[model samples]
Target: MASSLTKDSSGIPGSEKTFFGHPRGLATLFMTEMWERFSFYGMRALLPLYLVSGGTAAAGGSQGGGLAMTAATATAIYSIYLAMVYLLAMPGGWFGDRVWGPRRTVAISASVIMLGHLTLALPGQGAFFAGLALVALGSGLLKANISTMVGHLYDGPDDPRRDGGFTVFYMGINLGAFAAPLVIGTVGQQVGWHLGFALAAVGMGLGLVQFLYGTRHLNPRSGLVPEPLTREERNRVLRRTVLVVLAAAVFYGVVVVAGLYTMNWALVPITVAGLLIPVAVLVRIKRDRELSDGEQSRMTGYIWFFAAAAVFWMIYDQGGSTLAIFAADKTDTSVFGWSFPASWFQSVNPVLIMALAPLLAWIWLYLARRAKEPSTVVKFAAGLALVGLSFFLFILPLSAAGGGKVGPLWLVGIYLLQTVGELCLSPVGLSVTTKMAPAKYASQMLGVWFLAVTAGDCVTGLLSLAGVDLNTTGVVALEAAVAALAGIGVYAYRGKVRTLMGRVH
Candidate 1:
């Protein structure tokens, strides 16, 4: 798998691939990632709380409250946005391959995101929804491209320092994620929504500037022009067939949007048709096998991680949903005679992620010296267990408080625990897939990686629909089931998974 890489003529990343007392360009990428993450998480932190409630009371919500959206719609909308963000990686990847290279894509996408945030800062109803669509589109381009750049920073898939590099990069992401809620959420909640969203816009603008300044450290385009199509490649039947399929998709989307279709209509038909349509087309290609052997192996790994990732996200991503609402209504947010806003509780996870990622990396390094470090499956299993335990931990305080007001510490403790679990699993998954996937299907495997996230989030959407006014027993049970299922899958794939990963060095 590593053999496919070709070094730049200068032959860097030689025996010693170090720069600025670290792996080459690590800090450059770090700052770039930091601003990018700040924009992303800042936007995300505001989304659920904003949508479910609207703006803070200081902004435009009821009595300094938020928009007051139903939990079901908020959760559904969140899931759809996240799902679309990842799914659009397909188009993002293609664009990176075709028109704008990764650097240009990153800059342009971030700029679009900046515009979206600016739009949100405006008061017009049309601008409000349009801003959201813009954010989704912009995120679609940026999310995948930034990660691809991380991969581009290295030459070979199996670079020994790859894990550490991703960990470092992961820290950049969480740093942004950490600051967003605290900074923007605080302003919106304390000041007003317009001011808060404007802060988010500024954050994204910072990212764009950082990306542009750091472009020189980046790799140039690969110049992979698509090969010309021949007679069979230009088949009229296939073109017409694709057109028909698209038209059908458009019609289906309109029905679903209009509420003429059933609730699960989007989920069921999309899942079924999406799965079948691919296999049907791929069946023809399977004969010629454009996919390499490594591609096949990488594809296999992608599915397992994707499934596992889905479950992980279903539980972790709830910080903004079930947990956020819990903080607002139920927690004793008072500290030193001052009451804090509820959405601030969401800040704990990103904070913890940034703090723990390096600690976990160091701990793993220490363990590796004695051969005590866990494998990826083991790490993933531990993550699932931590999540399960976190929920279990919450049961105590929640029940004790009678689901009423409790100390902010309780929420902080839970988010901290959740962040530890995230550090154990989330960052490494990127490097793992990058190393495992075949060269030909790299981006697609990444897309498939997103599917796991989509599935997990889809489940979250369903679970989030359950009324929290109830015991939340349903949500807890659902997460537990998901955790167990993910754990079992990890165990089943342990051997082959390890082999595909090769030695972690």
Candidate 2:
């Protein structure tokens, strides 16, 4: 079974070449992810703005634009969509490891995502909703497995180059992220939303082509199913997967027929599931008698880091939803007597990420050389604090304006701080998850890390519902306080958790 899952190196030429002192496969994966993120973030930047846009002639309607959704409704749907995108990664990862392998899974996922964007480019509310569902599912399948493939490129877990490779991979993500909003956002907000959606489809199509061509250059094990199943096991898994999909479809049909298909209804169950799944997984892991004491200790410390990451994402992810709204409604976006699309502001964080990622990577390497690097726990705490401060910075401009538009610099400042926070935490979390995870549960732990983003998104949705109408300053201040307190609490306990992490560093 293991032999079937792994390919021999004799079949491929130039597979061992180094790119920038790392595996040549890194270049292929990098560009694949870059274009993938271009499509994903491009669509995301437009979703909120598109939702709130009025469709009626009297409401200043555009051709094939908006569903006349209220802010609460738009945000609710946005939150649910983002939550599902992350939450589904667990099942997606399992499917790859057990059934298909990363290469096939990513190929299928990219195709589906392109189809989703094309569907959105068509006219109708049905198409819009359908597109969103496809994109969410496809994204879930692609995101985790690609990262896993990156890990497989290394020779072993202790490889010093692993962290730097991830940083480079992360920069590809931001590079695409940085460009999408400026291009797609402008087209969607100014030219036409459907055109923008079509552009995203084009982006994914290009990525899929790149991925297909680059497959031969990757490691022979890059797409191999980790545990090849027996014939009977494969049949059983296929049957169960089909049944689950059918059941979900039936349930959704019933809800739609019963007039109970509101976004809030969907959000309620999804949010609860997102919060509970990780806890349930942790509880089960704790009960497993097979794990070593060291493994158990690392898992326990991981929970704390996971919680801190959740808080950071909950605050940071506001850039797409609430912050987008604020930019459209409250920020002065005029430059040289011309107003830009609100979605364009979404580009700022990624642009900053691209600029700062190398600097952060150098800083980490420098600190490591000097034996002065901060522990993972400390970095996580510091990230949370920076995110909190970013929110708090909004208070002055918001307070002074008193329901009026503020300068664009205010939002830029907020994004700058938040980007710094992201630099501190996000990549570190990915690197450390690989380091500390037990061999048997490595992929599962990575899925749980994604669930932190899912849970955070759920909280963002709920917060939007409760505080959407509150003064902007008050909302920002309240969120800031919660994050600040959480950061402080984490910092206080960082020492003990570091000890619990054993030799993970």
Question: Residue 363: error of model 1 in Å?
Answer: 2.2
lDDT of each residue in 1-505, candidate 2, tens digit only:
0122132233343444455667768778999999999999999998987887773211132334677776666776788789889988988898788878988899999999999999999878889999998999999999888888898888777877787788778888988998999999999888998899999999999999999998887777767888878999989988998999899899999999998897666667776777777678778876688889999899888888888888898888887877787677677787879877778899999888878877997898999999999888888888999999988987877677655678898999999999999989988898798788887786687787888888788787776655474236777898899899989998999888888899888
Error of 2 at 485 (Å): 0.3
Which numbered prediction scores highest in lDDT against the true structure?
2
lDDT of 1 by residue, 201-300 (tens): 8988877776677666665532222333356755864698799999988988899888798645654443344334334433333343776665555555
Residue-level error in angstroms, candidate 2, position 5: 31
Backbone clash total, candidate 1:
9
Query: Which ranges in model 1 have alpha carbons more than 4 Å from their true place?
Result: 1-29, 54-65, 124-126, 150-168, 214-217, 222-302, 464-471, 492-505
- Per-model TM values vs. the true structure: 0.78, 0.89
Model 2, runs deviating above 4 Å:
1-23, 55-64, 157-164, 246-260, 368-370, 465-471
